[model samples]
Target: MGLRHKKASAGGGHSTSGISPNSTNGTSGTSPDISENRPSWRRDPLEYNLDRSWDINAAPTTRVFNLTSSEIQAAPDGVLRPLFVINGQFPGPLIRVNQGDRVLVNVTNQLSNGTSMHWHGFYQNGTNWMDGTVGITQCAIPPGESFLYDFTVKQFGTYWYHSHFSSQYTDGLVGPFIVHSPEESKIQEMYDYDQVVLLQDYYHDLSAALLPGYLSSGNENAEPLPDNGLIQGTNFFNCSSYDSDSGYACDQNSTRAIFNVAQGKRYRFRLINTGAFGEFQVSIDNHTIQVIEADSTLVHPVTVNRLPIHVAQRYSILFHANQTTTNYWFRARMNDYCFSDQNPVLDTDVRALITYTNSTSDPAPTESVDWTYALDTACEDLAPSSLIPYDPLPAPQVDITYPIEISFQIGDFALDKAYINSTTWVPPAIPTLNQAVAGLQVNNANFTTSGVSTAFDSSQLVIDVPTYKVIDVLINSLDEGAHPFHLHGHQFWIMASGAHGAFNWNSYPTLNMTNPMRRDTITVDAFGWALIRFKADNPGLWALHCHISWHMEAGLLMQFQTRNDIMRGWAVPSDVLALCHVK
Candidate 1:
């Protein structure tokens, strides 16, 4: 286990017996009456039409090589302003499958550049080849080639897939992969109403939303271009202003998701933040939200003053509507870009807004019982325990317990937001790139793609098979903003984070608890450090870095792996494995 000290936001309000993300004012607010008067919004208006069929010749595609936003939407007003996209769609189609279903994802690459698809958080059990681990798992899918992706759905939850070979993920190569329930996904869990919003950000021009552009192509002196790293993929009819026939002049990568809800009903809103860079304190037309689920696992259900979702993470919430006649405009108006730059052009953050149907004004709030908050619980915090027995195999094991300090030197408001690791990381897309950019060095090793393995080399998502245990990861901030640090696969407990200029190690409530907020990803406050711990349990390559879509694409990633578990008897069936040419 890697045990390290992290900085934390010490004294925030807890959810238990308190205000959940669902209601803003809390117990004092009047609750909604579910007795009678069912309006149309109470009938679950948010329905997603998802269809899954067999496509024979589709490989991993990236649009950065040629196409622009204009080609995808095909309308002067329809353009989504995508920088890097696959199939010209941001957050690709919602792929539907069932458990135990052997699916064929025929990927057809359209870009001139090579790319690969990595199904984020998809436990590649028997089909190791399907893991898409980039260098370790398979080679990049070249342009104009077709790669047959065959794998069975083993787990169910809200997961996604995107390009790992390049920065295509930030552009829009990824999409939702929904593993339907055994009932064929017919049993719709309606809260009277439902909604889904995928929060994303795009650079004005060549932010991570597009490929490397000229800058990332090893061009250090390239001229910077305009870019706004803020965006959400689809357009909707809520607080988002759009010209029905003739639209307003918004940025190139702007689209809004709209939800029309009637008053006095329970509404389920699934919130997924896939933005390149933007941590939000989301508000839905001033309505508080009850956060029921995180990532894919069900939490104890905590209400929050804000629906704070970073990149590559998902949260499901229940909203109890209190009105029905008027338009209740919901908005995730971006609170602050943690990486804010003075240049407003490049800071076109993707703000979220939802329009609801409101009824006669009672101004009466809803009283909510059955509310739960706090991530640390008995079930979620527990490690993977085997109800069944298992056989073991030989593997390397190294336990490390050293202090690794990572400093984030905060800069001025305008320049500080542009936190690219290197001048190269800015790509040519950055307008007036940060020239005195510090070289990316991880564990004090200067990272280089030349294969000499730099200290900042995110080369390995995993440390070679149980090679190092007891690793200490410490990210310190020399500034005053918050930064979220995420580790893949393994959820680490926050040992300590500095808030109020000191570490409340002993006073920290959930440090050693029977129930801890079991999370694989967590946000580190701006200008602070966050320490997390995790067991090197899972044996595969994994990434440790910022969940911010733009950050990872900008070289803020490192990898390690645990190989002690070779997965005995976990072999692909002869028939299924034969799909590939064995020579």
Candidate 2:
């Protein structure tokens, strides 16, 4: 119930060399040691050969992964920083499972702090306790305590997993989560090779070290700018850029990640923005990326020279290696507008290499041109119209509508915090899910089905739905900053969005019922409003909040307790029940 930190010494004790024992060793059968496949200057492609395609109704295949959470002295961008790693890797190992498979991740906390792993974009339907959202679904896995995350993968495509407790993930507790389905098998024929490219904004300090300064009074919500950016956990940074007196040990020899491509072959690059903040404009010079998937939605291929991806968003792009045998920059440029505070060592332009040769030696720089299109001036999502899911499924009619407003408030004593309507979230001693189940069994008067909350805990806004209902959420952003709002346990259809003042109720009947962009995370631009609709059929408590680590920590979150009729008699597992009892 309390935020924990493992104090990291501020000297030159970090190293970015060597492979972790838990990393994948480029082999089949038992779980591979993921660090063995860590991206190097001239490493081969990280294969997506794991079996993920299966019949939807077939008996669920159980897959187990041993995830060890520990502290690591890592330099993701050559600047030493303390990272909360998983299985000894900076950007944790990938978890690939079939759409209908049961994923049991046994997580042992070796760090000196509590942690919980949220399966980003996973709909934990019948097993909401496994949603892994600390204080929302269950308590954090206590330090030295082990917890089993058991959930079924209902949806498929490029998704991710990260620490959902406080700002822990920003310090390096993030990784790729790919769910392959029958639909992906049909799309796989379009490309010969599949790989993952992680783009992140790097900081030289632990998030715990930065939180106090950020949360202090009078800061005015100015976000901490990153020291650098990374491509697949590696990038080049000049040691001389930071003064020796600056207190950061910079290694000038740190290498950038390299992807060796065979000429004339087509490759599918799954790009995941796992950074705490910073929307990256990803581009590989002289190459046109044909985007075939957005988040977990498989879409009709849309081509672009550059793709602007916000936090927690994923895109699968296909590109042909038909160019001349030379090295080209694979860029993931962190949007400068996202940073209010600047860092002298920060190079917003993050780059990696795409080489035709297998040599680790640096290749001769070749001339490459960026597309002529103007860059996006606003931090918004890629247009919803451009992405149409290949398998068109019409959105169901809304049974009820909830018009909510999200804003930031400078509370008493000038402390800045975010709010969803009147409730500014603070972690409950017992999860809302646990509270709801207990309340429902006793028929607590505060609990209701499908309407406004009746609970009086101003900090915990619980939307109680006794039965299944189709809900429409019209989200209005009262703040000046754009927020990437993500919903747990379900993907919603983007019915309508506008940068204008409000959602005109007059246009309700004219909304699109045909297939719209259905994704788990969406952005509501500054002073903008977006109407999203989803069927609240998933049975359990789900957290809907901004994906920004800073904002979420500042109380920008709310929960929905759906299908309480099914939850009243249910009981949370003993292992999960035990986490709350730890001191």
lDDT to native, each model: 0.42, 0.77
Point out the worst 10-residue segment of candidate 2 by lDDT. Answer: 1-10
Please identify model 2 stretches exceeding 4 Å from their true place. 1-60, 359-366
lDDT of 2: 0.77
* Cα RMSD for predicted model 2: 7.1
lDDT of 1 by residue, 1-583 (tens): 0111222220112211210112122111111332132222111112132222212122222211122111132211133343445444444555544445555666766765655676665656556556654443455565666566666666555666677654556555655565544332332343554345556554334343243442243332122222333223543222134345533335443233334455566666666666555544455545667765565555544656455566667766777767444444344434333333333333332333333422322222342111233222110111211001111211222244323333332333312222323211221211110100112212222322222133323322223333335443555543344445666555554555553243444554444433334445656554445555656655444556655543444444555544423422233334323322322
TM-score against truth, every candidate? 0.61, 0.90
Q: Give the range of the ten consecutive residues with the poorest summed lDDT in model 1.
A: 429-438
Clashes of each: 94, 8
Give the winner by lDDT.
2
